[model samples]
Target: MELTRIGEAAGQRQTPEDLRRREDSKAANNMVTPQEAKERGITWRVAPPEPQVCQFCGQPIQPQGIVLQNMVFLWRPNVRCTCEKAVAYWQEYDRKQAEEKARKEDEERRRAMQSRIDRLLGNSGIKKRFQQRTFPNFRTDTPGRQKNYRVAKEYADNFAYHKAKGDGLYIEGTNGTGKTHLAAAIALQLISEGIPVICKTSSDLLLDVKKAFDNEGVTEAQVLDAYKKVDLLIIDDLGKEQCSDWSMSTLYSILNDRYEDMKPTIVTTNYNTDGLINALTPKGFDNTKIVAIISRLRETSTVMTMAWEDCRGK
Candidate 1:
């Protein structure tokens, strides 16, 4: 007769060989007590097997985990274990928890960045007309359009360096040749990079100044300072409106402020130099101020002419 351990359950006698094998497994991981095993109608040993019971179902004890303490257990599947269902469930639960945490963190970061972008764009004074235009949507069907697009993209990509070096651009083309589109693309790209850019048409800028004059509550200096202080200033449709004594003077002040400070400015226009001069100094007005403005623009700007016909029809 095989002798049972102290407090062994008084049922299901096991052979000496069988008892020895079971004892080895229990000693390695389980926290079994003879009295407890006897009450449960199971084998008696020094300890229970790892994960003695399925944590989820609390059914069928198995040698699936290691017993680190009297009752505490850690899952460590062994060859003799029959607790596959319980092990798989906990593994999947932990995995899903990790994934959900990561997703939430990513979403939070994205929303924070979008909020910052919105604030910067709001302060930029970019018009609603060109808000949707970007470099990818810019048409490059013609060779000239392609070259112009490439140059504009290069300028945008290296905006920090170009701005630091006091370089600017003069984009001249007929209406509908994508000059405004390209300029807007550059402004949007810089804005996305956390740089502030002001985009407005010459006519609108003059109207803003005029409104300041009419409204004594707003000062002209405050209005003008915004244009001069931005990282980039885009004057779209330059020379499109007839320059007035007040308009020309305001334009000179804004341009000269940037010129003296070495800030970058991009001017989009339909007129060549001669046409621009004609437009600027209409009715035999003294061309000296206009000449001075043009001189400063030419000195710091790389003139890019988009010769393609208007693509608005296409």
Candidate 2:
């Protein structure tokens, strides 16, 4: 018991010299004396130094003119009096300025990234040659016929089928029923995935083909080649083109070539199957050729019918 008590007492007691040494070590580590800082050429002034006399105008020095100066030269006096609070305020200001600068740089970087994405979506022709000839004008914010006319799940399935390099699609729907929207949506989605797509109205395409024929030396074969080779082609508003030997024959040739190659083509027509057959068969062209083209198209394409009540006014 006595030995234990003695040991406890010894542990509790510390010599005054030892205590002094500990304090000295801590002070040495933390102390920043003005005299030492002056030798190091660091000045932290909280206010202006007292003028022995004004250098510019002869005047007696005032006590209020003497400002406190730290060893670090970070703080300067606003007025003549030494005030540590002023130094604290200036430090806070500098910290805020640094934060603001960092935030601005971050915002600028975000804007630059968004700009690159926009360029890729809007103007870059990196996907394929077909993208160079067509512009996508669909907007997500358009305020009419909001519901998807194409059943979303089935449409997605069909999209997957085409995307897998399987075959083409045929969309049957009435006007104002979002058939064009579905076609545009598919094209836009493919574009995002780095695939090339060409979208053109059927009537406009026929007119262009007609113009190519009318201009001497410009063979329609070149135009037909362009139509036949794209990754995806969307022929919108079919059965609306003027029926003629050249128009019917040209359309059949493009469709037949794409069918044989197993390339995908999406056609949205207001006409039903019977009407389409009749339009393709219109008196002048060979009926067997028209039948053959339609048969090949049916063999390689999945036909989807989109039916929705007109919702433009409501």
Find the candidate with the highest TM-score and give its number. Answer: 1
Give per-candidate clash totals: 10, 5
Q: 1-314 in candidate 1: lDDT tens per residue? A: 34565336557567898899998867664643444444545542345444454565666454333344343344443333236776787678779999999878856754554453334333455677778889999877788889988899999999868998778899987888888899999989987876667788888777776766777666677678767766788898888776778777888899999999999999998998888888877685787777888888878988889876667867
Clashing pairs in 2: 42-71, 43-72, 43-73, 44-70, 44-72
- In terms of lDDT, which candidate is strongest? 1
- Residue 174 miss distance in model 1 (angstroms): 1.3
Model 2 Cα lDDT, one tens digit per residue, 1-314: 99999998788887898799988786444444344455656455553344344332344433221113424433222232234554566677789999999878856754543354333223222234333322233322433323333343344445646645647677777766666666766766665655555667777677656666676755566556666765677788887877777777888888888887777887888878778878767675567766776667667667766565653445
How high a TM-score does candidate 1 get?
0.60
Q: Scored by Cα lDDT, where does model 1 land?
A: 0.75
Candidate 1 residue runs with Cα over 4 Å from true position: 1-123
lDDT of each: 0.75, 0.60
Q: Estimate each model's TM-score.
A: 0.60, 0.48
